[model samples]
Each structure stands twice: as C-alpha cells, then as structure tokens.
Target chain A: MNNNTSIIVTSEKLNLQTCYDFVKDPSCGGIALFVGTVRNHSYQKEVTLLNFSSYSSMAVKEMTKIAEQAIASFDIYKIAIHHATGDLQIGDIPVIIAVSSAHRGAAFKACEYAIDTLKETVPIWKKEHFIDGQVWVNTHP
Target chain B: MKIKVLFFGIFTDIFGKTTIELEVPSPINVVELKAFIIKNNPKSTALHFAVALGETYADDNARIHEQQVVALIPPVSGG
Candidate 1:
C-alpha cells in the first residue's frame, strides 16, 4: 500500500538524514527537504519548550495519505514525512518532510504540499510552554 | 456495550487521561455517543472534535458497535 512513501510518527527524535535518504532516488535529479523546529517565542510569549503528541496510528495513516497525494498530484519520485512527539526544547526538530523528483520544480512543490497537508490532516498536536503557562496550539480562538 | 474511546492532543489534557472506557446502554451512533460524552463532561463541548472509528473518520450517524475503538480528534497542529 505504501510504495515510495516513508511515513513515521513517534516520540523519538526525527532524523533529517533518514528522510533525505529515503526520498533519494537515482533517477531523481532534485531533492527538497523541510524541517520544523520548536520556536523560542509565540504570540509575544517567551516559550520555554513545546510538548507534541499524536494519535500515532491515525497520524501515520494521515501522513501516508499526504505523501501519496503529493506524489499523485506532482511528478515526485519518492517522499518522506516524519514527526516527533513528547517534550521538545527550543530549536528541537519536531517534523521533517523530504521529496525527490526528476526536476526541482516538482520536488519543491511536492515538499510543500506534504508539509501543508500534514498540518491540516495529521492527528498531531502541539502545546507551547511559556515561562508563565502553557497552551495548546490551535485549541482555542 | 462498552467501548474504549481514545483522546488525542488537548483532549488528553482536558480529560486528564488518554483513554476512557464508557458503557452505552444500546447500539449508539457517533452523534449519540458524542452527546453521551458531552452530557457527562460538559467542558468538552468548548472545543470541536471529529470522531474516528478505528483510524478512519466517521459520519455522525455511523453506527458504533461494542468493543470497537473510537477516537475523538481535536484540531491538528503538525508541520
């Protein structure tokens, strides 16, 4: 079912090299990668850390769907989407998306689509912890 | 019938646990189950949640069976 897509959701750290390698293909001439890090600030708050969590099985399924959609919509060769859960400190890598295609245009487009779709569909959530308190992202208005 | 309802993201924080086993007197649909949950814990009504049967999203009128795995998915924020 999952052909050239690598979809992972875990509490362990996300590895950029792994995703890059998975999407690397001999025929593909271009590779695009995206890495998401825990920012130090949000909404004028001095964020201390971030806590990420997910319904792992659903998240993986959703990510796989995104990868498949990117490949189908674009001329991509292979794709990988990986995300991390649990406590994340400032600058910690939380997510990574890599795409490879015969040309740079398709690679870049597919990479962007993968990340954007993941944010919308994957069952992962982030809690931003500030020096004062903590709040879940996208939870409230 | 009894089913285990899983909570993800902020639902975990609001519910104070990851999963809960709830009993339904009869075969319940997704909408009914959601109402049953909300009637018990009204605070959950504050945030919208999507229902999933196993790993797939379900319609409100979808019938839920005993011993099935259900999940209440809140808004996602992954990138």
Candidate 2:
C-alpha cells in the first residue's frame, strides 16, 4: 500500500522504525514521530497492565479521516498512524504517528494533530488493570 | 426496523455483551435510538459517548436502518 498516508489498527507490536521509514522521503526535509507507550500508573493507582479494544471498522475509518485532515490542514507530505489492540503491558508501544514535511514546523504540527485527533475521535478504548480492580480509562468524570 | 447495536469500552461492561439486536420503529433517528438504549441500560447514562452509523461517526439526527451496524462509542483514551 502507498505509505503516503497509512492508517492501521492491529493486534501486533508497533515498530517505530517502520513508521519513521514510511514517512521518509527524499523531497521531504523533516519528519516527526510520536510514540505512545502504556504507562505504569494512572491517577496514583499502580497500573498492572492495559487491555485495549476497538470497534475495528469505525476505528480505522476515523483514523483515516484524521490523517487526511492533518495532510489537508498542514503542509505535510506523508502521515502514518498505527494503533495496537488487545492486551498490553507497561512500556509496550500502543500507538505510533509519523508525519513528514518540507519543513520542521509543519511536520511537528501535523504529527501532534494526528495524535490529538485520534484520541478524541477514534473508537479505541483502554482498560487499565490495577491491583484492586480494572477500570476503563476516559469513561468517567 | 431491526438494527444491530455494538457496544464498546465500558458500555460492554454495562450491557454484558458486545452486540445486541434491537427492534425499533422505522424512520427512527440516532437520538431516539440512544434514548431507547439509555432507558433500557441505565448504567450507560454515566459515560460520555457517541454513536457511529456503519463506519462513519454519526450525529444525533442521523437515521438508522435495518441491519445497519450501529456502534456506541464511549469516550476514547487510545494514544
């Protein structure tokens, strides 16, 4: 598939190098990448691990929209967004975003926009497992 | 019209299942469907959520049809 703008929702590990390489271009001077890893804690609770679930069809569709938006809103040449589903432990990479542009400013802006928009719009959910119990993140006030 | 409702995130916990079949009147919009779900599953009312008709994020006014895939999406936390 053309890597100019890729949206992936998978149960496999995310390779950062692959994302960086996908956005690499001879004409593009700058590339920005953002990696989201499962953290060890949340709100003072010790998180043991995380389990991610997604409405796969809608998640991919929404992610594609975010990438297209980033490309249109910024002077970016390419964008890649990958997200992992299923069980994940702390330090595991769950999401990766890469954007390339002719200049550093646009690349940075696009990269940030991609991730922020994904969190807000995508149909992916994370459940944080704690010692006492597990709770779905971002579902409460 | 009969539609398939797929629940995600905490909604699955609330409904005790991932997918459910609902029979509703024809010409029902998303707002009425949501109200029906909240009426039956009161626990779902606590979370902020949205509905997706097929693969598209739907507004409250979007119409739903028979056998259409409708998903209840709770606030997402994916990075």
Please report the candidate that would top TM-score against the real structure.
Answer: 2
List, residue by residue over A1-141, the lDDT tens digit for candidate 1. 577988888888899999988989899999999999889899888999999988888888888888888988999999989899999999999999989999999999888888877887788889889888889898321
Q: Each model's C-alpha lDDT?
A: 0.87, 0.87
Best model per lDDT: 2
TM-score of model 1 relative to the true fold?
0.93
Real contacts recovered, all predictions: 0.78, 0.85
- The interface RMSD for candidate 1 is 2.5
- Residue-pair clashes per candidate, as listed? 0, 0
User: lDDT per residue, candidate 2, B1-79, as tens digits?
Assistant: 8888888998889888999888887888989888777777746356467888767879899888888988888888888
Model no. 1, DockQ: 0.63
Chain B vs. true chain B: TM-score per candidate: 0.89, 0.87
lDDT of 1 by residue, B6-63 (tens): 9888888789889989888687999998878877773635757889997987999999
Predicted candidate 2 versus true structure: per-residue lDDT over A40-120, tens digit per residue: 989999999999999888888889888988887999999999999999999999999999999999999998888888888
lDDT of the structure predicted as candidate 2 = 0.87
Minimal lDDT window, size 10, model 2 chain A: A1-10
